[model samples]
Target: MSNYSIPYHDIDILIPSQKFEVNFSYTSSQMPNFIDSMIMRLLRISPLSVKNIAKFLGMNQRESRIVLDQLITNNEVELQQDGLFHLTNKSMKYFTTVDSIPKVASILEHTHSLIYELTNFNYIAQKPDNNMYGIKLIATSTHAANSENIVRDRFQKQFYQLIEEDIITLKKIEGRPSIYKMGTVKKVKECTVRKSLDLHVDAQAEPQAIKVLDSIMSDELKDKTYQALGQSKKGNNIRDILNNLDGFEQLKLNQYFKDGRFLAPNALFDSINPIESKSSDGNHLFIGPCYSQSNSKIILNKIKESIAKNHQVSSIYWLAPDDVFWGKSLRFNTFINALGQIKTKQNTDLQLKCFLPMHDEQDRTSVNNYRKIIAKDQQKYFYGIKDGILDGNFELIVVKNEFAVIVLHVLDSEAEYLTSFPFGSISYDKQLVNGLVSLFEAWERPKDDGGISFGQMFKKHSQS
Candidate 1:
């Protein structure tokens, strides 16, 4: 049908039945057309007439004859005296080459159940004296018992047969898990594949800020005290009082009568309870007792509101006495979610600063764990201060540089509290704002030249 041809003897050794080996030197770019590929693959097992090929391909006889004629002209197929078409030795060599097996295996792996059954048939077809040259796999109309087991058994048998025939290879490479290889698979010093773990949060998952906030607020009030103190002129004096108020008497005096001003527990709660209308203007700060998940959510919502109004939320700073309460009460996950929502829109403009006394090894470990769970991009916004700078039952959150919310814990000599709710206050006075802001800024500064930076701390702890 065409002029192109190759001497028959040159590729005689490529015939499958001859059991001779030949190197395939063709690149993937030179692969034949889909129809030719299918035709060659079909003829790999046995010769097929043009009509038979047409039937197999669901094509008309004339279309198949045209393709067969082109294949014959290219020396990819041969005409037999039996009036059948089969792959020439050259075509057989190409199909049987070890380089082709991985590609074939990949295709087989992607196929559904049909390939499982086909592999099983390939196993039986390869047995000595087996006359079966083709397999027809049909899906049963109804489910049958032991169907899965039957397929699995067949798949395993076929897998072993392929391994024995050198069509597939398995190797245990150093530093890598076991895997399958094509061609002469052998152990190597280095693994070709790299393994990693991906930890992801679903974007569609709703944040639980409201729920977490409610839970924290609903908890039994451990200690309550109300304060309405005027800003002290001497910043160092106030810092001294705060740092020295761990004793029962000092704790009580500071909690109940700060600067000779006091408010009832009910009044404190009413003032501090987040109101949407009150959040509209000015810089407000909320600082209180160790925050529960609920408290974190409430604070997060307030911060969200400030951001919504296009106000600059300067800082979220906390001072905890020890890591036990800090670790137990800090709702890192809930906070991350709420902050993530804001950051997704506004970015890392807000600052998050926390100062806790890492009194022991356990405290260091707990903080380290917290560092590991925080996202890398967010670590820049979050600063952790373990150096002892500020202490006592003090919680403070400042919003928009205008107001401050303070919570003081009331504790008696017996270590029991008079009320369940903690004492809280809201201050808009310029002096009080200045004093609190000054104190917060002073504490945020590094203790000495060699003090660890937040970035260095996160990196060192995250790796550990």
Candidate 2:
């Protein structure tokens, strides 16, 4: 987790794989030896005494007898009642009758470990680490695509390939090795990797989340994941985090949440900037691929322009839970200053409703963080976002009947060199503006007036 600096959430999933104990049999040959080789070759052709074997090989009977005695000890030869040395069954299998130069060959069996993904029958690097925690178990149906026969076939096909790649370290491979037998295929756990979209304020642009290595999520598993998340009680909690999200943000969620969690995708910022467009109802849309340097300057100018044109203004401003409220960007303070000045000196009838997500009502850190962002005297104008949504990454500004801007947020509090801002879209159309107002209205003032005043929240925390 320390390696990745991007503000991201992750859901651990267990990918199914099989650990195969493969028994491989191959013919092995020892280093060359003339005396032992000739003696065995002679005995293999016909039963021969020490004198006959020595005579055929042009060697002394004494030396040949010593070697044959050693061969008998090794189970390669035996002396029969007929007084002749005979090739043992083990020795018979070791040499071909037609070969003149004898080479001792023995069938040897060795067990090797191999693992493959059960979902696709592809090779995995190694066995899973059992010490790791929080990995969600995948259903058995996720691996129903590959049968045991298919897994064995894939292992057989890749066996030589693995050796060529030096993944298999068997040095002495005899001619045309094969699987003598296979151990029972057992299911084991593997983990999906975590990748994040990082913010580099000094670099050209923040890098998007990259594709994870060896994603075991197949199409079937992904469908099951989507269905699971949609039905889970915890998934309903994620819905709270998504409240008032724009269409583009919603689409990103639908595309990336295939892991059955509220995890942002690697290409979270890959969405193309829609420069301008018209709504179905004929409203003009102005969009900006906002630069991190200015921090939503285009949208701020729009807000200022709207402020200049209107005297009595009604607006709703929603801030992301963490980054904006902590003053990571100076622009937030700047916006507050400009609006505060107008309300104080210009004496405009301005009604501004602001919302922030507070994780707990009595959390001292939340109360203090809110105080750091808005002045104690101005806390009355803000409301705490309700429900169980813990964090969000977008900001909304809706000036009723004037314009609305949805700005993607920068979540890294420690990032100094902000490269690129997510995006911002503004609309001046009356219907669009009214729709945004209604959206915020429902969120801020529900049927039971679910809104909790920031002033009261802070006071209660202070007392507690």
Candidate with maximal lDDT: 2
Error of 1 at 457 (Å): 3.4
> How high is the lDDT of residue 343 in model 1?
48
* Residue 230 shift from truth in candidate 2, angstroms: 12
Weakest 10 consecutive residues of candidate 2 by summed lDDT: 194-203
Q: Deviation in angstroms for 281 in model 2?
A: 35
State, as a TM-score between 0 and 1, how close model 2 is to the true structure.
0.41
TM-score of 1: 0.35
**TM-score versus the correct structure, for each prediction:** 0.35, 0.41
Write model 2 residue lDDT over 58-89, tens digit each, in one string. Answer: 88988888888898898888999999999888
lDDT of 1 by residue, 1-464 (tens): 12221110000000011011111111122346678888887787668999899999999999999999998997889999989897776677665453352111111111112212111122122212111111111223231233344544444445545546655433412121112322221111110111111111112211112221132231211010001001101112233434554532311335434543333332333334544544443323232333444345566666666667766666655554322222322134345445545541357645555544443333467456555344565555455555444344445555436555565543322211111223444545556556667776765556574443233335445554
Each candidate: what lDDT? 0.41, 0.50
